[model samples]
Target: MADINIQRKKSSPSPWLLILLVLLGLAAVGYYVFRADSDQPVTTAPAVPSPEPAPDSTTGAETAPRPTNDPAVADMATEEPGGSPDELAAFAASDASAPNYGRRGLEMLMASLRPLADRDDLRDATVSEKRDDLTSATSRLQEQGTSLRPGYVAAANLIKAMQQKAYPALEADAGELVNRANALSGRTNTAQEQQQVRDFLSRAAEIVRALNQPAQ
Candidate 1:
């Protein structure tokens, strides 16, 4: 057993060589880790888009309102000397025939009889005169807005006519007065005549005021 024995040499450490080996091992580890990381691209967050505002209205164009008519309102406006001239003109325009023609025609006929009344001849007085006298009396009963009150609309219309200074309208209004007078056909007495005279006179006063003002 002693004849064939053999031994290998054991190597001794070099400081510089040992250091170099350690550095090389660290470098290899770093390179392997970096190489793996480079294979995958860096993850990034997605971007968000902004939204736009919408337009208004389903259909195009904005429309304005139309004007309306009110008779009551129109009447209220006629409180002045010639308060509703335009309204009166409109009223006048509405009628093709004069509404007061009957009254005026009767007045004309009675005016002829004034001379007979002046002579105090009650017996010889014509039928037209009697009608006229009765009309005069009823009108007197209704003066200063007292009788046969048709409310604001009629009053405003009357005022408007006076304001306009339209001669034909004035004639029509006079006819209306005569008709109001003729409302009483058969009554015979001083009281009826006197009362009607007062009303007609009140109307006369309003007309006088309207006449005095300058036309608008």
Candidate 2:
């Protein structure tokens, strides 16, 4: 038997197998990157709050109104002046005891005289000293009429008629005027009002008597 030593050759792996292994490794890496991206939460902008509205300027508390003794005068202060003289006179005659009767009565009496005062005949006479008594009485009556009762206004009307030289009309209306004065006197409660009405009646009677007497 001959002593002979023999060595066997070792085989290397195929190139195709090495290539397949490298491709598999790359696919694993790509899959892991895609999975990480899918699992990550998306960031967004935060929400903002709206601003509140301001309060109104005119919504504050207001002051209370003042008290009044005469409600009609208070109401009249706020109302615009209107109505015809005849209409006011009608109201005066009908509503003699009403709260605004003073105003209505004064207006009725003034309506007759104001036109006469403005007339061409009376324009010069109104300012004359000869008419001083008449002018003074009416001026005071006018001043007091706003607060005084209707009886005073009725009395003033007679004086006004006499001053205007409307004697025939005054005489014609004398009975009616006296009747009205008497009725008004009965309606008044105060002693002063009664005394005034009495004076008015006496003056009215004297005037009627003087008119009936022949002029000297």
TM-score of each: 0.23, 0.32
Per-model CA lDDT versus the true structure = 0.40, 0.47
Candidate 2 on 21-131: residue-level lDDT in tens?
A: 999999999999999999999998897877765444444454555567674454334333433344443443453344444444444443433333344443454334323
Please state every model's RMSD to the true fold in angstroms.
18.7, 13.5
Q: Best by TM-score, which number?
A: 2
Among these predicted structures, which one has the highest lDDT? 2
Model 2 scores worst on lDDT over the 10 consecutive residues at 126-135
Q: What are the runs in model 2 whose C-alpha is more than 4 Å off?
A: 1-85, 121-170, 174-216
